[model samples]
Target: MAPLESVRQELSQQFPCRKDQIQVLSTLFEASFPSPPTTVVHGLEATGKSVVVRAVLQALDVPHAIIDSKECITTRQLLEQAVAATRNSVHQALGTGLLHGNQIKCETVNALENHLEKNIKDVPKFVLVFDGVDRQKEAPMTLLPGLARLGTIIPNLSIVFIITVPNPRLLHLPGTPHIQFPTYSKEDMITILSLDPQDIFLERVDEERYDYGEEEASEDKAWLWPRYCAVVWDSIGKGAARDLRTFTLICYNLWRPFVQPIVDGTHGTRDFSKLLVSRRSIFQGDEALTGKIISAKPSAEDQNNRSKPTFLELPYYAKFLLCAGYLASYNPPRQDKIYFMKSTERKRRRRGGNAGGRASKHRKIPRHLLNPSPFSLDRMLAILQSILIHPVAQTGQISAQIATLTSLRLLLRTGAGTADLLDPATRFRVNCSWEYVSSLGRSVGIELRDYLAT
Candidate 1:
């Protein structure tokens, strides 16, 4: 059998929904068997790029080295890690005690090449997979090409770079041959998730907790498991990411609630199905509270009574900052506010040579419809002090509170750079809801409605 055929068969069984990517990778693997070239595999997160490559190499029985770029910050660190992985692979393959002695440092690129040549003498052809290549903060431009050129310098060395960036130009490697792994669709995700045969829906009852007439309830649970899974997928599973690992985890947690009812023999499959179709409250709470549970959709009364812990948790001054920002965004300044005016100055010319320019009407934006506007630090502080019931004494403490708010992302900086907050160029904009603003005002014993235009 050809090498590519062998790899294709292994890939089809191990990794599904990746037929095209497997074909591309098998060809690359076949090409690298005789002599290797630098290959870059790029894709989005959770697309299974690393998994496919690892499966292919293992199936082909090719000795490979692995390096995580997050750990390798500098050129020297990259060289050291590469040399270490190479040594470990050699030790495992030949059953040699080559790694037992004192560590010999390989800090430079030349030293790395010499070390590779020495260790890989027995095993001539192998691959080096560098995961997270974009994570290298320094020397990526220099390090990538250098690693690629190692294939040419060494007789049978191939280098593969795994990156999350889809665009090649961002990494400054326009000439590198690349293969992309696309994100999976919802149907594809469902097909992949079904491959797992674990009895996730089976409910095992504890003998000590409660004793019933029946010893086990597998028949009842077996019937309802499929329906419960269908309801869960329709509700939130369709919107989730396409990663198989995450999808399987969600499936397990979603099935946990259905387990107890089946085990205790309190509810059967038919009852559960009716509740799911009528109320659709599976996502709201656990299975025990299915009947007693209210709809996940909130009513007007619920919205009014909703306790915003995030709003209530803020410092006193931060609430004032939010109130000030709301006022600044919705209300126009006096110089900017224009109305009908009678002046004694010279008449301005119109296009038809009229006596005065036509009056342009200024429109005021609705208070509720307004967005949070950027306010200077001094302006925000002034408003804060005026609205605050008790006066704040220290200037340093006020500055500290502003820093705290900025760190918590309640007060976002609106300027171009991270300049000092007190800098005249620096500004801030509050990012919160109108409901939250009013609630904060009420907690401070002030009615924010009075601040808005009628």
Candidate 2:
């Protein structure tokens, strides 16, 4: 119930430098009240760029106008909205509606210039924070020139434009200062987590049924403490600092239901088994480990099954992981237990097809893979099935494959594959053992015999 302390802490850590920047600009603005504005802070999303500007304004105790650049419906709409907001905020603050009575019929850039020149007469210094600038249709290139021209027309109108975007390089704004948003380090992540109140942490602990048994409690401080750290770390590593807010929300959601029941006396420590099962359910379904083993047979309707599954058609992240795993197997210094790649030769042998068959004319090679032509996903799946049944390969190899397959299943179940999998920036790496993989496959209704026989 207490306001989140981390937000405040993050603000405090960022405001000092930002305050100095605002202070200098404020001084210049005060000197140029009847003249043009000066300075602009611009950067991408989650970079604390907007936060810095807002914090500065707050510290200065000076009134400023903020235009939420994300609200526009289209490129033209964006320009219109921005100009309108700028004029309205200035008009409201200065008690003068210089451009209010007349319908200023002009282009976005020109109109904004006209409003600034005509309306900002004799007023003291003020700043404009343009958050969500990337959401605009155009890069505000026209507005920039207009802004520059204002300095000559009105010497005292010192204006500092703060533009927040996801990509700074694309802006091409001249004479503007660019700031890069830093990625959150592990220590930063921990600090962010620590900002949560003691009650929140306790609630998460209780909800997850994280209490240790008498024997384990005496031996260690927390139940599954290492596992907890790994999970939190993994979540944070999935994206940049902007994602921290979402990561915290996920933790809160995961912990909320379990803790509330305990507090209400509707649940107790004896119900830990159910809580454990529930937590597992959040990540993976109740699928047998054997289900992950790939198997293939000439289908009863084989004539209709001409299309092969290609890796290119797969989500980008999945393809990247599969490729990384395949490459890792041939190479060394692997992060996982063992990476696996299904041999095309083995698949041909199992299907009684020629091992030296000509490359298919229709197969399209993905741009990332240098190969002239790439095997389809169905073909890859078939090859994987063959590897699962190979006598020369250890059962552990097959098991490991099954585990990777199971992780993929979990990703799909969580709907993570829909977006994250499609993103080129996202990738997956499984650290599970073969035994666990085999166990997971069985849970999902796959049989070891099917894998071995095929």
Candidate 3:
């Protein structure tokens, strides 16, 4: 085991967001150094189990052998590998002549214990690290229990088993002191991810790096790197499994799309924040820049002239279904049309048509300002069929499209209501923008310009 101070120092340098784990592990290593009770370290994948344990052991300058149990097929193979690793470790540290022979075969537990005791006499203790013990259990290898009993079987030797299993009972090794590493919470993840140097590279890039007249009053905010890293974690890291390595990898990959242009002056970074928030600015551009050229002789060429919306890539029927749902939700019924009427009767006198409802209902509201209202699935389907120019949309096609939309969160099912009691009725609401809905409608030859408020 290593000195407590040095172990803590190494941990702080290499591992972040695991102060509690590091503290406890440092104590364990210090107390168990030179000789150990069987120690089992288990946690979720990528929780830094192997890294922490190995770091502490190395800090203490212990003679240790690390082997992955995954490569061992049987008890014999495990024993051979562990003994070989231990032999190699001892041979390197103490040189030749320490053991009777350099080649020590471990065919039995007794022979292994005898070999370890005789060969590892030079070091204060010998650490045998078995990584991926869960794999060894699956191999049904009979070596784990024996290794767990190493404290009594051999003196001056300790065994460490690293696993991903949460329950120590699963390993069937009773009385072994097991150290559990919990998965990182979102806040913990953010803290750890913020410390990564991936985002710092962008801030410190040669061309983009700026110095404030004084350290405290620099035009570049000191918080920019942390804030940027936080946004990345919130945008992409949170959705994935809480693994530091994986999160850092995602942030690394995002540097080009999100940070490169800003550094290269191809695009400005001031307005770029979250992925979705800065999407148009980072990827899309002004209408004039993206507008397609029109041909004087138009023959089936109009489709290519208009700038297609992002949702244009959706399946054909999914597009029409979204447009129909949008109309059904945003456009009120004929009787309630006065609610959305452009002018009141008093105002119409200044203009034209006599508004015939509560005067309050005739308040002018822009179509674009209207929020999507929940509508029955049947009504949406009816609108879809009526607006579809092609008869290819069959019942199966409609059902499949609705399912797709629901999965994509473009259509959401609301609570069921009763009226005629015509089976289990479902209600749905369009969950996207008027611009997107209108684009879909236009793509399918249905004019949605009149249906939307704006």
In angstroms, give how far residue 365 of model 2 lies from its true place.
Answer: 31
**Candidate ordering by TM-score (highest first):** 1, 3, 2
lDDT of 2 by residue, 267-374 (tens): 544455554554555433212111235332446566365563222133323333343233222222331122233433233112223458965556543322331122
lDDT of 3 by residue, 210-316 (tens): 53233332323334545565666665566653586776665555555565555566544344454346443432322221224743346665666555444547888
Q: Rate the local accuracy (lDDT) of all candidates.
A: 0.67, 0.44, 0.65
Backbone clashes in model 3, listed as residue pairs = 1-33, 2-60, 367-453, 367-454, 368-453, 368-454
- Give the higher-lDDT candidate: 1 or 2: 1
Better of 1 and 3 by TM-score: 1
What are the runs in model 2 whose C-alpha is more than 4 Å off? 1-44, 74-76, 79-83, 95-104, 138-153, 158-175, 196-231, 234-242, 257-454
All candidates: TM-score? 0.55, 0.42, 0.53
The candidate with the higher lDDT, 2 or 3, is: 3
Per-residue lDDT of model 1, residues 66-136, tens digit only: 88888877867878889888888877777765575566687666788899888788885778888987677
Highest lDDT model number: 1
TM-score of 2: 0.42
For every model shown, the clashing-pair count is 0, 38, 6
Q: Roughly what TM-score does model 1 have, to 2 decimal places?
A: 0.55
